[model samples]
Target: MPAARGGRWGRLPERRARQLQRQMQAKEERIAELETENAVLHLRLAQRLRLAGTAGTRWREGLPQRTRSLLRLQQAAQRLRQDLRELRAASADLLGSCRDQQQDSLSRILAAVQSAQHHGALPSWRARALRLEQSLQELSARFHRERQRRRRLHNRLVELQGNIRVHCRIRPAMPAAAEPPDPVSHSSSASGDVAHAVDDETVLVRCSRPGHHAVHKTFHFERVYGPAEGQAAVFADVCPLLTSLLDGYNVCIMAYGQTGSGKTHTMLGPRPPGAAQADTGLIPRAAEELFRLLSEDPSERPRVEVSVVEVYNNDIFDLLAEDGCAERPGLRREVLTTREGRKAVSPLTCLPVGSAGELMELVGAGLRLRARRATSVHADSSRSHLVVTVTLTAAASRDGTPEPRSSPSPPQAPSCPSPSPPATGRRPRAPRRASSGSPGAPPESPARPAGQVRARLQLVDLAGSECAAASGARGPALREASFINRSLAALADVLGALAARRDHVPYRNSKLTHLLQDALGGDAKLLVIVCVSPHRQHVAETLQSLGFGARARQVERQGGRGRPAPRGPR
Candidate 1:
């Protein structure tokens, strides 16, 4: 019985061991399955992380390009989202890098789209960028064009600036009546009183107060035709300037008037040579005064140099020089500074004079060179402006006392020591003519010495500034009138600028203005002599002159030594 029981225990033990082995196999199979699943999951995660790192590297490499590519990808994803049904229905194989890669890229793209949509910039950003590019291109083009335009404008302005001085003198007008009588009473007196009034008027005129007409006469610079009687006065106010010239101040006296007025007579005198009556013009009177002053002061004898020039059609010509020399073509205008540091032109030719007879000869030579033409207003009217300048250079001591060197010095020595009349020195080649059929060229003259202290007394006789209708001009005369009017208008502009005190005045706009710039606003003392007719026909011209004078009184000048302006009138 013991042997049978031991056999049963052994069988039971074997059966239990078989059951335990089966249990161990099932646990091992479960463990193997978990390891395989973990391996597959790990492989997928590693692939995704590698792809993300690659994408990040690409993003940093070229941000603008990568951003554009990413934007395109986002657009594709958006299309997929919008047409999900079509994407799902399409069975054709889609080119996708990796399932994990697509999923990760799609997720990032979706987030960006959502953010862009929330910010309201997705649709308009592309349009805005395109517009910005176009605007940059346009701005670049405009910058180039404006730079070129400014260059051209600057060049043009520089070319127009020349050296000249211009001044406008208007004839003075009579004062207007302070108050007019009642219109009704004036009309009644004119129409109601006729023949009986005429006979009574003669008896009343002779029997009434003998000085009644004189008392009624009003002294005026302009003409007033009425029952009043007054003597015609000429240059009454300008006499002071004439006197000041002998007192050592450089003076410029100009007479301005219309044609058929007394301008020529006042400046040149109406009496012809060898006439029965001796009539003297302002020129003769001024010359006589200068002579008298020189004779009175024998100790302070001055050497006077005179130059006569005419500015015709904006061209300068010297009267004393030969006609061909004076009328040289293509001479450019240039400004020069005197020893006193005054700026003026160097084209004027000067000649020394010792007596009044020599001055008269010079004046006659200038008159012959002046431009004159016939108009309905006058048979022989001056068509150009005449400028007579007398320069007096004085050498004085430090205390303003006359020195021995003040007397006229001998002619200057030649710069080259008078080289022996071209022993082998060939003559200089002549300049080529501007065009065919031109006149013969004149001989070249010696250059004048520079850097001389000169005080100039100028007398200007201006041509008439008249309208075509008033002057009855035709053909060439009409053109001349137009030019004259245009120059006058330019003068008016200069005066207006001076009156207004504008910084950049337009003196360079016209030759006339350039020529008179110094006289009008320079160191010289200027006296404007306005000549007006005593006839009622000249009322308009007189009024115009008076207006010019009013503007002239406002001109301010740079004082000598760069000092402040004086307290009195310039």
Candidate 2:
């Protein structure tokens, strides 16, 4: 039934149905729109979700880096706090140190103030010290005076004993030869102190050999000279002996040694023009000293006369004789006995020496004469023994004292006019060195003695004792060497006898001894300069020379008494 009804209605409502279906379709389309809108909203929401997720992932990755930065800032803040704490502590320590230093400075200042407060007593102490120094000075002055007095007394004592004193002098060794193969043999031994000076009084000589034990000897003397010593040193020790001559004493100075051992050099010294006055030999210095001493007291000085002689081949020749200068040729011998048993040269040119210069001239003249014609070991060698006499006689003065005759109006001696060449000497016997007499003066008396203080100072340069074989001599030089050795032996004998205090001496042994008889035997002060070569090669001759010195020393030690010269008018 319902179906029939529905069909009937359906047929009647076709138009209406169509309209209602359209309405339905509209409703369906609306639904589809709603679904599509929803789908679109969902797609947009998914895209927003994807973007938020990516932003969250980025935040997560950056979180650790930010955390690490915060941690580093915290650590830096901690370090800053630590540094401030240390600064605070250091400030405290510096304040404490300053306090301590201030206290120390205060203490030092207090100490200085206290010292200054106690300075009132220094003046008294200083005054006391000055007084003590004054007293000490006075004592020193007194001691000096006493020493001087003692020295004077001792000099007088030594002068009174007219003994022969020996002084040894050692010359310096010259440059050695080119180094020899065996220098030990030519060299001085280690024990060369055999010539060593222990003091002013003692000398030691030590000897040693390869197979033999060392042997030594010691000698005593008044003075000794070493290689380093010079002429001034020797003269200093001898000055006292010279002073004795001024006090009215006879003095004889003799130099003896072997050939080439400084014998001539010690007496006459090196040739002039090259040497100085202070370094001249004993003879020149002695003359100069005489003039100086006389000048000190001219009113009391004695008249001086000089004569030079030479003993060649045991024959005495007057160096200032008239023979060589005036044609009275042959050598003049010494007159054996004179007025008072004295020795005098027959034709001695007793020239009056006014000054030291004149004395030097005479010496030069005598040297020239010696070199004129001579045979010698050395060209300038003194082949003959030289004897220079400086005779002093007291001249009358207003006060009865001695006076040196200064008058230049006296005559010349050994008259020679228009003298020859350099070989001949000028008139040596002039009354005075500065005398205004003729150049050709004649020989005259020795001197006019107002008082008897007759003193003869003889400077004897003995010919050296050398071996003939060593000298290479053929005739005259060999003969001269023999005579020299003989005369030296004679001298040694004389010294030995004097040392033994014998009653008689062998004065007649040789011409030299005979000529010096009076000066040797009498109470004459004698000085011997024993010159020696400091060479090992000269050991033999050195021993001989030293032995001679020893004997001479014995003579003095054994009381070789001397008589002072007569003090009154002759």
Candidate 3:
């Protein structure tokens, strides 16, 4: 029994040992699975770290390069602004230095003048010094005024950089009708047959003769021909208006004609030899007359101011201002408001002239500055219209009593044989413009006193309206002809409208209209001189001029101031 019990205990122990071995195998398998999962999580975490490092490197690399590029652009802009400021400062400094030098030169000249006055024989140094002083004084004054103006303009430029009103003048062209037949080629025999067959046919006059005919001979058309009539004849029609101007009206006299029609000759006499003269044009002539009338009357104190301007390609230029004084550079048109508020433009320049000599000088200077170019028609054809304005101011007796009358007679056409008498009447006065101001102020207004008579006399030498084929103007001249034709068409339209009494006139169509707005439509007395040549070759041009004159006469009649009727037969 003891041996059997011992065997049982041994069997139980073996079974227990087998159970412990199975439990160990299962624990080992579970530990292996946890180890595999831990390895995968470690691989994923390493990959994530690598991706973050690459993104950080890319961000770091791009930041400084972009920052540097931005810095460069900022630096360039700063430099450009700095350069402009420096240039403006340098210009101002240079002007100041010039003025200083001029003053020193003038002082030395004055010293020399004083010494020369006291000495019996002037030293060469003293004589030179005197002349130098006068020159320097004049130069200094000019520089000073220019500097002030420049400063003002600079300020204005800064203010108006992009705010200014810009305008362009485009001359309208007359739509061409069917070209007329060559008058010379129509044979009389052919005409007679055609006339008989048609019955209602119109016979056209052929002015052109063959080369064999004496009338067909060609003559050189001189651009600067001597005046068509004597000064007396030219002034005959203009005398009454001139008298009114002197009587205290702002008067403007304009010469309108085709190119090569003696506009310059009519306005300005033939150029004199070996002498620089300004008192040759109608402007100077009128100025001389005004002074003469003023000098003749002791009771009247007359003050005259003048402004000269030229309109080129619809651009306004101030001839009186310093050369290259463009307030807004590259602009074609500009407005000039007088201290009184009268506005004129298209490259306009205003100046004040106290005497006939000064006025003449100003006109001469303006002529020099005018846009002139040699063409087939004229040596120095004015490419644009020239406007010279004369403003006359008169003061009557302070007592307010009726002023003494030089001539009691009212305005009347002068009788021939007796020298043309001056105009006699109280000149019509106009309200002072809102733009004119005192002499000391900027000439922002163009208005003057109303009680004081004001007149504007305009002299317009219209560009010749020529066919492109006839003028042989190519390239630039062709362009110029186009512009000229447009301007003339506009003028013709204005005349037609005035003659027809249209309620709405298109005066704002072009620069020419704006420039001539007052003369054609304003209250001031207006005179137009239409010059014609009697040459048979110029018959077409002559006919055109006569037609224009006739139209103008019609306008005058409509306006209640037509030409006086012819007197009864002698």
Best by TM-score: 2
Regions of candidate 3 where Cα sits further than 4 Å from its true position: 1-206, 210-228, 272-281, 324-343, 346-349, 395-453, 557-570
Q: How many pairs of residues in model 3 come into backbone collision?
A: 52
**What would the per-residue lDDT of candidate 3 be over residues 276-307, giving only the tens digit for each residue?**
34324555566677677667755555455556
Compared with the true structure, what per-residue lDDT tens digits does model 2 show for residues 1-570? Answer: 999998888886888889999999999999999999999999999999999899899989999997898899989989988998998899889988988998999998888767756754657668888999999999867865874565456555775533667898876664454111222354533323235666766666665645555646676767788867777787775566666677666778889888777777778777644577555787777887888877875446566777778777776666654443544333455555654666666645666677888887877767665522233334444567888888776755555545555554445445343433322322233222333222221112334333435677888888777766545665656666777789989988887887788888897898888877666766667888888765554555777888889987776432234345565321
Candidate 1's clash total is 13
Error of 3 at 237 (Å): 2.8
Question: Compared to the true structure, candidate 3 yields what TM-score?
Answer: 0.49
Off by over 4 Å in 1: 1-239, 271-278, 324-341, 397-453, 534-539, 556-570
Off by over 4 Å in 2: 1-155, 159-162, 177-194, 207-215, 276-278, 324-330, 371-379, 397-399, 403-452, 556-563, 568-570
Candidates ranked, most accurate by lDDT first:
2, 1, 3
Give the alpha carbon lDDT tens digit for every residue of 1-570 in model 1.
Answer: 999999999799799999999999999999999999999999999999999999989878889987898999999989988798676555333535456688999999999999889878856878888999999889966865874465345333322321111222222222333112222233332231211111211101111122323111112222221222111233333344444444444567777666755566666676354432234566766766676666775645555677676666655544554332222322223344454444455554456677777777778767765667877666677777777877654445455444432333343311111122211111122232221111111111123222223356778887777757666788767766666666666777886887688887777666666666666656556655544443334444544654554565455554321221121111
Q: Give the C-alpha lDDT of model 3.
A: 0.52
Model 1 residue 409 distance off true place after TM-score fit, in angstroms: 8.9
